[model samples]
Each structure stands twice: as structure tokens, then as C-alpha cells.
Target: MGTIDQTTYTLTCPQCLQTEKKKVLDKGSNYGGSHWQEGVDFSEFDVAWAGGGTSEPVITTAVCKKCNVPPSIVSSYS
Candidate 1:
């Protein structure tokens, strides 16, 4: 199986000024490989994947639990 990296970040809601913690997975060399099939838990936030097809996928946006407003990614770390 290929290695999977996990990254955590904070997302802030623009409408309600709320902050939430989120996690994302980096398939790295596994990219399109099917070594893993587990679902990621996003808790109380909504997330979207970006930059697929030609590049690595990244979590770029999240939905705020407070007002249901989608927020931009603030910062992330492995």
C-alpha cells in the first residue's frame, strides 16, 4: 500500500466569523492508486477537493457549521 499523509488546518467563516478545524489527506505517490478506500471524517465541516486530474488534490474550501457559509482555507500542516 502507498503512504498517505494527513494535514490539519483551520477554516474561518466569513459570514459568521467562526473557526473550525479540518483534516485532509495527501495520497502523494499513490495519487490515483487504489490502495486505500477508507472515508475521511470531516466532523462538522464541509470540504471540497481541488486541483485534481493534472495535479495533486488539495482541500481548498470548507463549510462553516455556524452559519453554513463556505470558508476559504486559512492554513494547513502535516
Candidate 2:
């Protein structure tokens, strides 16, 4: 019914603590009085191999430039 805001996902590498933008879905920080669940959904992409299993839920296709974090952390800040 209304407009969807752009969302910016932040991921910090556990090894280096590098922060990266996994995806930009909605816009605006405020939800315009809309109720949104904090960090509930996730959009997984193909990231680098961190020497872990594909289903480890720790590795992601989106790597942080600074810490090279995975995409799993994306849902943590939604």
C-alpha cells in the first residue's frame, strides 16, 4: 500500500572486524511509522571461502572490504 524504504545491511568480519554493505534493499533509516522486525530476514549471496562449510551460516558471498565478513551477519542488523 505504501512505499518501501531502502535498507542497508552492515556486516563485520569476525576475523578482521571489517564492515561491509551486503545489500541495499530499502531506503531511509526511519520506517515512516511502519513496524519492522529487527533483523529477521536475510538475502544470501555468493561470497569468498573462509575455510568453513557452505552451511556454516557464518560465511557469505558479501565480504567486508575491511574485515571481509560474510553475509550471515546481514540479518543481524535488519
Candidate 3:
């Protein structure tokens, strides 16, 4: 099983070398129910747990704020 996490990324563009911050929310789990399971795949059964959105694997339109890259696709921004 994979653990879901919400993360903020500070991305630096190689072309323009401008850094920008973005938020990507991934809700791994939720609280509540008749009882909270310690270790279970609640998302499989609950609609509330569903649609824990994830960040895009690639963002191709990220523009550098400084020099502005020509729509460089983002592999990873740290």
C-alpha cells in the first residue's frame, strides 16, 4: 500500500531559473464513521475517502517568474 500525502513544492525552472511555489493536495484518508479502522483501505468503501486528488505528474505550462521559461514541463520541483 502507498501512503498519500499533501505536499507543497518550490519549483525552480532551469531555463529562466525562477522559482515559484505551488500547493498540491492529496487527501489520503478521512476521519469518522461507525468506527475508525486502524489499518484499512477506507477509500475502497467510502465515497468521502474517494477523490483524494493528486498533483499532476507533469506540468508543462509552468512559467518562470524571473526570465520565464518557454513552457517547460516540470518533472519535479524541490
Q: In model 2, how large is the Cα lDDT of residue 5?
A: 38
lDDT of 3 by residue, 12-74 (tens): 667655555544443344552122122112111111122223323323234444554533332
What's each prediction's TM-score?
0.47, 0.32, 0.35
Q: Which stretches of candidate 2 lie over 4 Å from their true place?
A: 1-4, 21-60, 64-72, 75-78
- Which candidate leads the pack in lDDT? 1
Best-fitting candidate, measured by TM-score?
Answer: 1
Tens digits of per-residue lDDT, candidate 1, 1-78, equal: 344665566767788776767554545364465232232446656776665433445666668676787876665556
**After aligning candidate 2 to the native by TM-score, how far in Å is the CA of 77 from where it should be?**
8.8
Report how far off residue 4 is in candidate 3 (Å). Answer: 4.6
Clash count (model 3, backbone only): 0
lDDT of each: 0.59, 0.39, 0.35
lDDT of 1: 0.59
- Residue pairs with backbone atoms closer than 3 Å in model 1 (clashes): none
